[model samples]
Target chain A: MKLVPLGDRVVLKQLVAEETTKSGIVLPGQSKEKPQQAEVIAVGPGGVVEGKEVKMEVKVGDQVIYSKYAGTEVKLDEDEYIIVKQNDILAVIQ
Target chain B: MKLVPLGDRVVLKQLVAEETTKSGIVLPGQSKEKPQQAEVIAVGPGGVVEGKEVKMEVKVGDQVIYSKYAGTEVKLDEDEYIIVKQNDILAVIQ
Candidate 1:
């Protein structure tokens, strides 16, 4: 089943540390700390959420750095995902 | 210094556990878990925050129940307070 997030939530697939960084440095997956990087898989519609008017800034396929302790982890069809609000995303990787 | 929260943030003074519960259960202050109830000390001027428009619902003197793990603990003038987003507040006690 496909998971569709509501409001300003964005579904992300965590990018393992082995991915290349913006500075062209390739990190090893065996790194001690988990990376905060992820690729956006789905983005909620930008609209009013919880009495606030939110605008989704990240789109699907965007690589982003999110807050470490933000979002909820969900497992869908054996695939793990992290769903967070747009405000939790810190930056977009080039 | 007086803390003036910005953009949907609320400054709250946590009510001690000794306060009475909704059903009139008088809890002892020695309870192990910290109480999640607080009194609204200051309300932010809600407006556009992180590109979202927010409206403040709670006002000063309102007793509120907030998320257990939400908000930042702050100390001002030797008095402790919790700085939380308006959304973190779950309910207002009558």
Candidate 2:
């Protein structure tokens, strides 16, 4: 979907939770908590700095690791998404 | 209680949740969710920046706003606390 971030917030598309268990048992979504993994789809240019410009360190399409409980949840067009700031991001996976 | 931050992590002392409602009705802890406000107690020097020094913007004793679900929970001496990186901090309230 065409989702745009507001201000310094970024939109993340969550990755699906693991379905197969170590023993090869398949678990359905109703039986497990949602995983926190995500793929970056959009990001703000950067946060404002003293009326100056500050470019962002991360770009779109980067896989990132973030706090499972971090960011505010939002649902757009029946799709779940998260809104987090750059500072809330822990690290980016190459 | 004395707490120390490791690496780029910071320690925060949580603020007490409001007891009185907007209409002055008293809500007890068991009936309400914990508030997410905190006062900074300690901070790491800074995150690694190309092996160079980068001082932290927030300082000790600064009141901060953070994600309600951010950080790992830890209990020291029966007191619950959170361990979060500097990046997890949203903003410092001056």
Per-model TM-score, in order, reads 0.45, 0.42
TM-score for the first chain in candidate 2 comes to 0.66
What DockQ values do the models have? Answer: 0.04, 0.04
Score residue B90 of candidate 1 by CA lDDT.
Answer: 47
Per prediction, fnat is: 0.04, 0.00
- Residue-level lDDT tens digits of model 1 in B1-94: 7999998899999775434544322333433333366789999999988877776777999876555456898988889999999877644555
What docking grade does candidate 2 earn?
incorrect
- How close is chain B to the truth by TM-score, in each candidate? 0.79, 0.64
lDDT tens string, model 1, A1-94? 4545555777788885435667543555676533488899888675777656788888999998776355655443356566677888888999
- Tell me the TM-score of model 2: 0.42
CA shift at B94, candidate 2, in angstroms? 37
**Cα shift from native, residue B26, model 1 (Å):** 9.8
Q: For residue B91, what is the lDDT in candidate 2? A: 77
Q: Model 2: how far is B56 from its true place, Å?
A: 9.7
Instruction: Give the Cα lDDT of each candidate.
Output: 0.70, 0.57
Interface RMS deviation of candidate 2: 12.9
